[model samples]
Target: MIIGIDPGQSGGIAGIDGDASYAVPMPLIGKDIDGHKIAAQLKSLTPDVVIIEKVHAMPKQGVSSTFKFGMGFGIVIGVCEALGIPYRLVTPQAWKKAVLAGTTKDKDAAIAFVRRAYPSIDLTPGRKRVPHDGMADAVCLAEYGRQIMGNISEVS
Candidate 1:
């Protein structure tokens, strides 16, 4: 199985096993990342490899928010390491180019692309009941990983 993670409060984690796929919003305890919960989720998935979105602080973002984002990213990496799950970081541009192809590079476009690709999968598993960009991106990242690395033994 392969796992893809979008590390942020609004972000999500996705797992793809054969033709089956599952996704959920990043678990949080209050405003902080619930590392234990995330670790448990990852352990349950038993991913041979994890693909995390390579992200950086954006200009105009507040210092506090940037710090929190960095902390979230670190928590995800730490969890993977604790479980000995090999992970690769892929930039949004790179994965989008591979998975989204000719579509415009934007949240709406990503949601549209994933909706079309995994029509049976529920993109909106949260309370909002709306298509989620983070979940869509997670699926894209997983697809990218699958494309680049064929089988479980092929993960590097």
Candidate 2:
């Protein structure tokens, strides 16, 4: 199994086990708090690999976002490393392009593409029936990981 995470002010987790995909939106937390959540999730899944979103610091945005993202990412990395699960960090652009391709750059467009890709999966946002951007992004990362691994198998 492989899990892909899209990290941000709010983060998302997507898991691909065999041919199935599952995703959920999660609150971003401090290192101490997030470590517990990561452990719980990892314990449930027991994934063979964990793919986390690479933190890309934007210019002029101060250090707060970077720090938060980095802290969140660190907890995830630590969990994966300790469990001996291989991990990969993919860039936002790479995941977006892989999922959206020629679609618009808007979040809604990306969500639509995700819905189309995983029509059977339920990724609705919030308590309401809206699409979750974070979850959708995570799904994209999962699918992208699938594609990459599929290509690698073909090459080998």
Candidate 3:
């Protein structure tokens, strides 16, 4: 299994193996992060290569939001380290170029791309009218790792 994570409140985590994949929002309830819950998911999924987004705070962002993002990132990394899972951190630019180049550079475009890539998956029609871009990105990130490992031949 390959697991990919986007470390933020609006981010998501995904696990994929062979023809199966699972994606969900980051396990954060308010300020307290449920690391145990995320750990459980990863333990169950048994990722051979865990991939996480290598993101940094932007200069225009507020201090509190940046700290929160960092905190969430720390929790995810902590669980990976504790579980002894082999992992890699991929920068957003690299992954986006590798996986999202064909898409139109928007959340809806991302949703459409993931929908086409994983036809059996229901990444479309998320809560309300908003598509789950985070989920799509997480899955795409996992696919990026899979491509790097030569596990899948989809990358161009």
Candidate 4:
């Protein structure tokens, strides 16, 4: 099984376990980054491979926000190490380029991509039907894992 995570406070995670596949919000502690709980969730999945989005400091970002993002990134990496789980890193550019090229692929594009890739998956809620970019991004991340590290399959 392959587990994919986008390591951001507003990000999402996706994984395949046994015969099920799920894409959901990244588990976190109330308002803080909680590496232990994240690790526990990953451990329970018993994934053979874990792939995380490789991100960096972008321009025009404030110091505090940048610091928090970096800290969260490190925490996720540290949790993987502590559990001795094998992981692979994929940059956002690399993955996005592989799936979408020569276009300004924004959140909406990501949602569309996931919908196209998994036409059967239900991505929206009942009332609002709001588009979920985080979930879409996580789905794409999992697909990137399949591209680079063959043999992982989506849930049926």
Who wins the lDDT comparison? 1
Task: State the displacement of the C-alpha of residue 26, model 2, in Å, after optimal TM-score superposition.
Answer: 2.1
Q: What does candidate 1's lDDT look like per residue over 1-156, in tens digits?
A: 888899988888888888888778888899998999999998888897899999999999999999999999999999999999999888898888888888787888888877887787688784777787788888888888888885544333
> Hey, what RMSD does candidate 3 come out at?
3.2
In candidate 4, stretches whose alpha carbon ends up further than 4 angstroms from where it belongs are 17-19, 101-104, 119-129, 151-156
lDDT of 2 at 20: 84
Each candidate's lDDT (Cα)? 0.86, 0.73, 0.79, 0.76
- Write one digit per residue (lDDT tens) for candidate 2, span 123-142: 77557577778777777777
Candidate ranking under TM-score, highest first, comes to: 1, 3, 4, 2
Q: Which digits, one per residue and each the tens of the lDDT, describe model 3 over residues 82-137?
A: 99997888887777777788766666665776788887666643464666778888
> For every model shown, what is its TM-score relative to the native structure?
0.93, 0.82, 0.88, 0.83
* lDDT measured at residue 62 in model 3 versus the true structure, 0 to 100: 98
- Winner on lDDT between 1 and 3 is 1
TM-score of candidate 3 relative to the true fold: 0.88
lDDT by residue (55-129, candidate 4, tens digit) is: 889899999999999998898889889899878778887778876665576778778877776765556634537
What's model 4's overall lDDT? 0.76
Alpha carbon lDDT of residue 43, candidate 4? 86
